[model samples]
Target: MARLRRRPRDPEGRMTLSEHLREFRRRLFIAAAAVIVGAVVAGFYYSEIFDLLTDPFYEYARNNPQVDASINFAEATAALSNLISLSIFVGIIGSSPVWLYQIWAFIVPGLTRKEKRISLAFLGATIPLFLLGCGLAYAILPQSLSILYGLSPSGTSNIQQASMYFSFVTRFILVFGIGFLFPVVLVGLNAIGAMPAARLIKGWRIAVVLIFVFAAVATPTADPFTMFVFALPLTALYFGAWLVCRRLDKRKAANRPDWLDVDDTEASQL
Candidate 1:
């Protein structure tokens, strides 16, 4: 195989079509196998998982009463589908490490020593941030559900289909996970000094608006309580990111000075 030399910082390094295909297949197999293993393991606990998943609906059902009666045709199909989906979801989560490693390994060889260190640090920070986000989502899910359910008027609000519920739950986890990583991205930028704290502070107004907007949109729940809860944490993380970036920039400005300045993203470009 001809060694393809390219810049690691850019999204596009150099890779042949074959290389891409090969990597895709490799990642796919590993991901699939991991999911299968996870699903099998989870199969034993499927009933328990279903019960847990249905809790929010159950809560709503208990309170509303009519919601249970409103559900019928699609509900049964959705129930099984959702269980399967949840199993797949867990499998993917369990297998994430394998894929992460595969990705890291793919790029590691191409990276400089400096680049490798940066990549490792990013990986380290990212994994924890994502996990924290997922954990937070799980903790807040019941609350979010309650809040969403609370918004709807007392009617026959049948949340029948399991698929719909699963989608909502999985999406919640994903959005939270990605949202949590927002600060990490910003923090990484600050570490290298790409984003100045002063600028971030200046942009607070816009940032706050954006946070709320994101809360409004990203949230499938679309309930104010849920939106605010999600947005509040992200807003806090944003400031936290700013503070972190500020300190790093200050240190960078004081110490070794270069055209690179304190731009974190540029620094990470190895």
Candidate 2:
């Protein structure tokens, strides 16, 4: 019988740069595969997804008599292009959990056991928050379309290209989902001791400004109402995270031994 050979382990159990690259490649391939599978599944439900996305546009056209609005396919391949793009978008969203877990797994190797546990908790929180953001975007789609159409002059037909409209809708939802991830990132940084509650509190004004700016840029429409709708909740989440951090800091300080407070350069009093 032939003897089986074991793969050589890295010295000190630490992965080398080449090993790191290989691991990253593996994770990337898995994530891509998951996305492709998701896309295939989404393709099967293309009609349903199309209707769902176009619902807001139809609603706008139905109620508004001043302007005729319709999504038009300009080219012979435009419908196919839209279908492909929409399927990919749904694929990415549907496979978010798998990709998100892959990302978390990639980072887990470098984290301590405790940090890994904390990160797992955050990862669980992240998926739902992202979906929540997307749902909110879908909910406000009608209002955003209303605001945009309201700006168009009366008697002009708003013939929206199907590809452009779907692109805008997908981008809008993606931006919202990404926007909601910032608070989770903030909380994660706090958990890692990288960002303190005091620092967040001190930077409140700047943070608020930045949030509004992000909301402004993120929303598909230029209107302030959408911006406010996006920004206000995020601002609230920031403060809420700060409060959680503040409590965490207090708890940590209370649990810490007094001797640890002495600077490493100074002699400790017995």
Candidate 3:
């Protein structure tokens, strides 16, 4: 019987489990430090960040005579806590590259050359796709707010809790951003040979239905227009991913000899 060969270890000598833990701790410390620095910088410009976050609400209020948009803090510590939390959020976003790189550095040594290439490609694609999703959410915010605000009775002013409002906005942005990465994940699966493009294409109708249902549920606004606003881009991205997977599958097939390929009839016989 023949034994399978193990792949070579990384050039850096292997260490005990304790050393790995220490390395992880060091990387975590660096990432934490970067976040702290970012938070400090963000703290200096808290007012600007606050204004930016509240712009959509203000714009909606300005246009609608009946809807008065104002955020209130119910507790004494609410304002300070909210500001601190906002600064932390800003810090994390600002220091994302540093922390992300640190994480990648920690994991890269364990991966093979092909795995490393795929990981790098995935990382490269993920950031921009996430940012684009966030951008789309930001663009949709004004309309979403307007739609929701319109629901209030004519005489009642819309007063929102500051922390709650911030949470909602954060969740909204994150959901959209992460949702946009679905296609990227699909592409990555295809690239890794875990999911075939043909399977994805075959399930197009179901996929579209699920996408729309998700958009409807995920969107904060209770309006069809906003649902479509979220769904349209995702639908486009899904099809785009399908095309990419199809091309990759074709390329992979092209690299193999024709005789090695089995026709459907031959495959059925086996």
Using lDDT, give the best candidate's number: 2
lDDT score for candidate 3 against the true structure = 0.87
Pairs that clash in candidate 2: none
Q: For residues 99-193, could you state the per-residue lDDT of candidate 1 as single tens digits?
A: 67777777775677766786677777777788888888877887777676666666546555556667778898888888888887887676555
Error of 1 at 226 (Å): 0.9
Better of 1 and 3 by lDDT: 3
Residue lDDT tens for model 3, 1-270: 899985555585465687679879999999999999999999999999999889998889789766667889989999999989999988987787788788887888777777778778878888888889888888889888888878878688899999999988877887898899999899889988998999999999999999999999987667888789889999999999999899989998999676667776575323
Lowest lDDT 10-residue stretch of candidate 2: 6-15
lDDT of 2: 0.90
| Regions of model 3 farther than 4 Å from truth | 1-9, 12-15, 257-270
Task: Sort the predicted structures by TM-score, highest score first.
Answer: 2, 3, 1
Cα RMSD to native, each candidate?
Answer: 7.0, 2.2, 6.3
Whole-structure CA lDDT of model 1:
0.75
lDDT of 2 by residue, 1-270 (tens): 999985686533468798889989999999999999999999999999999999999999889866778889999999898888999999999999999999998888787877889899899989998998899899998988898888887678889999889989998899888888887898889888999999999999999999999999878789988899899989998998899889878988999888889999998775
